[model samples]
Target: DQIFSSALTAALMVGLAALLCGAVLYPVVVHLSADNEQKAREVLDSHISMMEALGRAIAKRDSDTGAHNYRVAWIAAGIAEKMGIEGNTMQALIAGSFLHDVGKIGIPDAILLKPGKLDDTEMAIMRTHVDQGKDIVIGAGWLDGAQDVVAGHHEKWNGSGYPARLQGEAIALSARIFAVADVFDALCSKRPYKEPMSFEASMAILEKDTGSHFDPGVMAVFKPMARAIYDQLADCDEEATRKLLQDRVKHHFEQ
Candidate 1:
């Protein structure tokens, strides 16, 4: 009876000690977790700011108003959401859309800003922007997720694209989705080379290229949403578009 009592008492003492230790450490652990989460948020915000700065630099170099980046990012994110793409994939699509033309920074102004169609040689040189963009984003760890759209946006659905000529599902989904958004925006937006085409004309072109220049699946999802998206963004100025895109970035990345 004496031995049993001692063993029972020892077990109770050990249990009490463990409970005390947990009580003492729980608050510290909770504090550390909260601190870590805040630091992570700060790091993410800094990275996003850096991405915006690089996008602005590319726009300045290309003589663009930078509205294209904001518009495309907004449009792509919308389409992605409709297609049920969420989480990190959606975030990558947004980032890639903003930086898709970043490689134009490396192109000569003669080619990038030419008022007329590029000749064969100039076109060849211009296409190198895709590779240049890939190299630029590949070096940054935070920007790594963007490499897919950067490297593969120019690729077509039928294997007629540049650089790699990737076909069908072989191309990154983000790139495919961005291609649809990019072409739609370019057609509807005014440029030095030509006046903006009407929404009808733009959709017509996108429809015609369904399986040739664009992914059929992505186009199908975007077709219904195109008119609303264009109408909403068409009249908005750069500031408005920027604010809209910032809200989207926050939704996908910070929230």
Candidate 2:
């Protein structure tokens, strides 16, 4: 009887201990989950902040009206997402979109922020950002996946764009899509060199570029989303722009 009772007591104690452990650990598990989510948000937020800082740097360098890069990046990401990109590829697109001009950081100020058309020599120096950007991000070990964006965003479809001049299907899709968004935003937004173009005029320009300057298929993907894209462009802010930029660079080349 004693032995049986002792065995039973041990079993009961084990069960009680397990129950206590579960009860105690449940809240800890919940806390950890919450903490993990918060951390993820912070990480995302940090990336956005970094993107914004970069944009501001560009604006400072060029005496920009401010927030154009942010807004353009927002529009670019919208177009990309609407086209069905997701996951890391989407993120890379976002990051690359913001950093596409990062190479400008290396361009001579005379060419980079020039309010007038660049002379051939200046243009030559200006285009080096593509390679310069590639080198910059490639050297930055912490910015994983940024190298492709830094290097390839300048590539154009039909092999007309600068730097590598990679031909169709060879150009990074993000760059192809970005070429449209970036140029469109520039056309529509006020700049030091020229007054902003009317929305109608901008559309006409994009339409004119069609197959030559922009990707025909991506342009089609963008056409239906114009209104949504416009809404997003209007809604953008520095904070939002930063987020869009990060997602763009992160997603661009993967899909």
TM-score of each: 0.92, 0.79
Candidate 2: tens digits of C-alpha lDDT, residues 1-255: 999999999999999999999999999999999999888767766766676577567667766624766676667778877888767766666666666777677777777767777888888888787887677666553354556556766666677777778878787777777778887788877655678777778888888888887889988988777756665565566667666555655445322
Please report, as a residue range, the 10-residue window in candidate 1 with the lowest summed lDDT: 59-68
How much is 205 displaced in model 2, in angstroms?
2.3
Candidate 1 RMSD computed on C-alpha atoms after optimal superposition onto the true structure = 1.8
User: What local lDDT score does residue 73 receive in model 2, on the 0 to 100 scale?
Assistant: 62
Cα lDDT over the full model 2: 0.71
Best by lDDT: 1
Local error of candidate 2 at residue 177 (angstroms): 1.6
Error of 2 at 243 (Å): 9.6
On residues 83-134, what C-alpha lDDT tens digit does candidate 1 reach at each position?
9998889888898889998888899988888888899999999999999999
**Clash pairs, model 1 backbone:** none
